[model samples]
Target: MADLGAGTGLFTRLLLSAGAARVDAIEPNPEMRAELEAALAAQVAAGAVRVHAGTSEATGRPDASADLVTAAQAAHWFAPEPTVRELRRVLRPGGRVLLVWNDWRGVDAPLNRAYGEVVAGFTEADVPPLATRVPEAELPGLLPGGFEKRLFDHAVPFTRERLRALAGSVSYLPSPGDPAYAAMTAALDRAFGEPAGGEAPLVYRTHAYLGRLDG
Candidate 1:
């Protein structure tokens, strides 16, 4: 299995836990790969996993080397044409590519609304979310032979600090050293204001697409 754009190996860990015998976790960011390697040290030592610095457009993996390829919440940044071709070249004849997204766009709740408003306000207004700039569903259309999609309700337990951490993790949001970072944290802190039992739901819908590209 090949895990592309495997940020901090979150999905890669899931794949391993789900019994994917062997996995090549491909991440482009050195920092994230470092964290992934540290977290999966035992797995690496046992040959259960290997971490590589690579991108979705150029994985540097041998042709048709994977039985399964997955990208979670990372494809939005990929150049679609190269990404499609790369996935095709990386997978074996019967291999499948799975794209997963945990989206919060349309959740109808007060806390979620406040959180969204803050993020939108905090980011560069001129630079829109890639999902808004282009319909994300179009990736499925880009698949040579279409794909199957499934949507499930997904939620995360949230607290003020966790909310701040989650916001910081987003690629577009201000990082810790940015001028707006503290302000963004403050806004998130207010949005997450005093939940019963000190927590609330970070609601989302998990959208998954699975299909084989034409051999």
Candidate 2:
């Protein structure tokens, strides 16, 4: 499997656990690559994975060599045409391209609303979800030949730690030291309470777009 833009190897780790034979974690950001390396050290030592520093548009794998390719929450950063071509070049005939995204559902909920207000105060824009912006209408250009998409609805248990980590995962948020950062924290506190509603988690819609290359 190809794990594109594998930040800190989160999705890569999941793929490994799910028994993928091998995963080539492709990441372009240096700091993120370092984080990925640190996170996947044991996996690499166990011979479960390899890491490649590159972008989705230019994965260094041999042509038509991969059996399956997956980009988790990172394809949006790539320009569709080049990325699709690169993916096609590396995927074996009849291989599948799976695009995965974890979009938070019910963003209009009370807690979510407070979360958005904080982010908006800082960035002048709410932290727009990546999946919602995908060019589903122009998908033909993104997938050579044709493809199918599937929506996988799911939820992840969220706590203060997870929420904080989620906020940190985003690229635009002000750091904990920044002044606007306090506002975000305050917003989070107001929205989720000091400890967050017990174990009951927010649901997220995990959208999966599986596009196969023509044989």
Candidate 3:
């Protein structure tokens, strides 16, 4: 199994826990790959994980060798056509491609709104439209092949620490030494201080689209 864009190995850990005998994690960003490697050290030592420093466009895996190809939140950074084409190339006959994302519910509740505001502050208005944008409504056209779409609503335990970690995982957030980073941290602190239920879990609506390679 291949975990494309396996930054920090979140889903890579999941894949290991879910009966995958081997996991090949492909990551492009050097810093992210470093983090992933650090996180997967135990698994790597046990020979359960392999880290490939690459991206989905060029996974460097042999043709038709993978049983399953999965892209978690990283699919939003890829070129749809070439990515799907390459995914097809690496998948063996009857192999499957799975695209999954954990969409945070940010607009519904008070605490969620506050959290969303903190995130919105980091958005760069001038940044160009990204090459890979996963719009739920546009999934069908992106693949050009038969696919199955499924939605799974799940809650992940949320703490101020976890929230801060999530924020750190995003690319748009101000860098550690940047002036804006202090302000963002201040905002998050203020937002978390308000009276709220303790250890309340945040709901993440996961969208997964799976397709069989047309071999």
Candidate with maximal lDDT: 1
The C-alpha stretches of model 2 lying farther than 4 A from their native spots are 105-110, 117-122, 125-135, 161-165, 194-200, 213-215
Off by over 4 Å in 3: 31-47, 126-133, 195-198, 213-215
Candidate 1 lDDT over residue span 15-112, tens digit each: 99999999999998999999999999999999999999899889989998999998888767778788879888888888898888888777886668
- Name the Cα RMSD for model 3: 3.4
Order by TM-score, highest first? 1, 2, 3
Least accurate 10 contiguous residues by lDDT in model 3: 127-136
Q: RMSD per prediction, one decimal?
A: 2.6, 3.1, 3.4
User: Order of all candidates by lDDT, from best down to worst?
Assistant: 1, 3, 2
Give the C-alpha miss distance for residue 155 in model 1, angstroms: 2.2
Error of 2 at 87 (Å): 1.9
**Residue by residue across 1-215, what tens digits does model 2's lDDT show?**
88888888989988888989889898888898888878778888877788888898899999977888888887778798788778888988888887777776444455556566665565635555443436676656666667777765555666766676676556678777667766676666666665554533556667777887563
Question: Candidate 2 — number of clashing residue pairs?
Answer: 0
